[model samples]
Target: GDDSFDEGSVSESESESEGGQAEEEKEEAEEALKEKEKPKEEEKEKPKDAAGLECKPRPLHKTCSLFMRNIAPNISRAEIISVSGDIGLRGRVGVNPRSFRFFRRGWVTFDRSVNIKEICWNLQNIRLRECELSPGVNRDLTRRVRNINGITQHKQIVRNDIKLAAKLIHTLDDRTQLWASEPGTPPVPTSLPSQNPILKNITDYLIEEVSAEEEELLGSSGGPPPEEPPKEGNPAEINVERDEKLIKVLDKLLLYLRIVHSLDYYNTCEYPNEDEMPNRCGIIHVRGPMPPNRISHGEVLEWQKTFEEKLTPLLSVRESLSEEEAQKMGRKDPEQEVEKFVTSNTQELGKDKWLCPLSGKKFKGPEFVRKHIFNKHAEKIEEVKKEVAFFNNFLTDAKRPALPEIKPAQPPGPAQILPPGLTPGLPYPHQTPQGLMPYGQPRPPILGYGAGAVRPAVPTGGPPYPHAPYGAGRGNYDAFRGQGGYPGKPRNRMVRGDPRAIVEYRDLDAPDDVDFF
Candidate 1:
């Protein structure tokens, strides 16, 4: 009985333990289900919280940032942001940082998807106090902003050292004349002295060696030693100095050409190429061929003549001025003497009545005459002068006596007539006798009858029609009589007062006596 009771107790304990374990598993499943649902519930509430926090509704489409311009000077970036925020805009607002006084432009980037056109439309007519704001989309603003950042953050400065070096090299090349000849050719000495003293000195210094005594003297005196001077006699340094002197000479020559002779060096001569053969001056050496742009020898001579002509008058005037100054000082006033340099003509002529050669009209002054000529007859003045000179020469020639004319003696003979059958043929068939019809008048057709039938010619005083003047035609008798003296009918129908009959008859069947009027 004790063992059975113990077994019953064990069975009861096992059942109780199984029931407790199942209840604990059910609670854990319920807790896990609640925990899983909590996340979904929080997720659902999260959107609502976000919506409540947002100050403005989100847009449905992508928004474009805009570059606003023409903003009032008094408006600040914060005010712009506030104004945009009032219009439900949520975006970063940036004003041009470069603006110090008047903030006339800015950029706006939206945080949410919003239609750019709609934002612009709503922002239209936005005014800060009394100042209006202009807003529009500038697609290039992004690129400009990038550029501005780069400029502010990564600035760089470049130097043209290579260009300067190349220029220096070219300058040196222009001055150094390389005199090279064939392998077996003999060297010829040039007789012309060097034009540049600096170049001549450099060449002499390079060729002549320095003595030890001179070197010591220069070193003790703190002056440039002769041996050290040879260091500066490097070909590169010598070439540079020579080029500088040559450039100075060239500039002076060009200035003289322009100021004194009114000649353009570039226009007269082709620019020298560094590659061309060097110019040689000697009895045996010949000059290089003339460049394409070089002025001809004749043109150079003419220019020289004109230059001399212009210079003569100015020199004379300068000499006269100097002499006057000298006389005023009661001695030769060297310091007061006028320099004999010729400058450009800038002297205005006296205001005097000037006549136009073309129109023969008088002008108030030379200026007015010049203006009139330039405006009216500039193109034709040269042609007109040539024509006038030609006519004058022609008139002079016309005044001379004419030479007598010699006439050839005519052969005495009777006038030759063309044979009747040998007369020249007409281009077209002749419809009438040559002299019968006048030019431009149509020829009358000949009336054809039996052969040898003759048509009598009407008398000059007769009417044209045979039955005229008998009845209805009687009215025309007076007109015909007035035109041809009198009308006579055909021989077949004669009438009274007919010139063909040479008689006049009264109307016998009419009234016998005339009544007094």
Candidate 2:
């Protein structure tokens, strides 16, 4: 079926075919995605410029030497600063041309190897002050970028872009400030949020809500499993029941996929750009040349069977009459009408199975199955929601204990206290407690316990549990507490007036069975 599906998907593949230039795009991308798997012997390809000129592949450094070098030169230092500042505030990368083809100009090549699109995507709502510089500089930069390939470069690249972008943007920002400072006025500089991600976290809450709803739905109606892992046996099945289960899962998965497919359409703008099919893999591993192609009729039909299963459980799936009906009506595969039926009046899990705690139906996808469980099992899910909400509330109200207000630690007692003036953080020779000392070794405490305490026998060579000898140096413990002194109170855990934060421990009463997504 996968083979047949491959054949059917071929014609549709071209638009999806990494575009017409996919083969060309990756020849460039692979040079970037050189994992260790690539033979170490393979010579690294030289980078080129738009005019076929050998732009010395000087290290691609800073956040964006490429943008600054190509686009902002003609612009004033002040304006450049402002643009750089805006983008820096906006984030490391910003624009997204329709295709990876835009990277060749060297303004920015599509380093499929460099997945900056995620950063750019995250920056969509990222706001910045408009650069005072004229629009022509921006236009020039665009022209230069347009001259070469860009999008095709992305394949396996990730995080380094974030670090490099942050660093370069800061450098440019500082430079801009020095150049723009008024004759007598002092320059004010801004620093990045110590927190690497300046943006607020919103995904966890979204995912939580989605999971909860799916669980509720699944319990009410027997629905798909949360995950459809790879089945580990023969493809065509011998057991009819097992085959039916697999079919059910595939059907539900198709429904879920339909939602995803619709969301993927660019017109909807719901899909993340880099997530567009092959944008990542094609740019990374499948580079160099297209493998001519693969297609065949038998393969196509086998896949059609799979597609039928997927369509069967959908509420909005397409359909047509059966082959028998179609033939009667002068048509082929009239049974295609079944596609429409697949989506119509689907089974009701909620009305029939409200008594069960978990839905038994499953799909060939983990996500859909999980979604079903969360959406259909509301009562059971409430327990987990309450806990998460409690945790969330704690985060909101619990202040992080203040560092500056933390009081110096109280002098430690016995076992290993370092002598008073010992500077912190140095290791000291260990001196075990008297009772723990090797046989025959005896040390006396300098001072006796409490005035009224009984005079217990000393531990020099006494029996186990006997009081330590009078001269034993008990309070002089050390903690990597540098050279002969006590550590500076091992950094206080809690401080006073300094906006103190609290950390509440879990209540024993809380439920532990709630599944995490």
Q: Give the alpha carbon lDDT tens digit for every residue of 201-264 in model 2.
A: 3122112124777777887888666684654455442121113332232233222222423221
TM-score of 2: 0.14
Q: Report the lDDT tens digits of candidate 1 across residue range 155-186.
A: 01001111222222223323343333445875
* Reference-based TM-score of each model: 0.18, 0.14
Off by over 4 Å in 2: 1-517
Leading candidate by lDDT: 1
lDDT for model 2 comes to 0.34
lDDT of 1: 0.43
Query: What overall lDDT goes with each candidate model?
Result: 0.43, 0.34
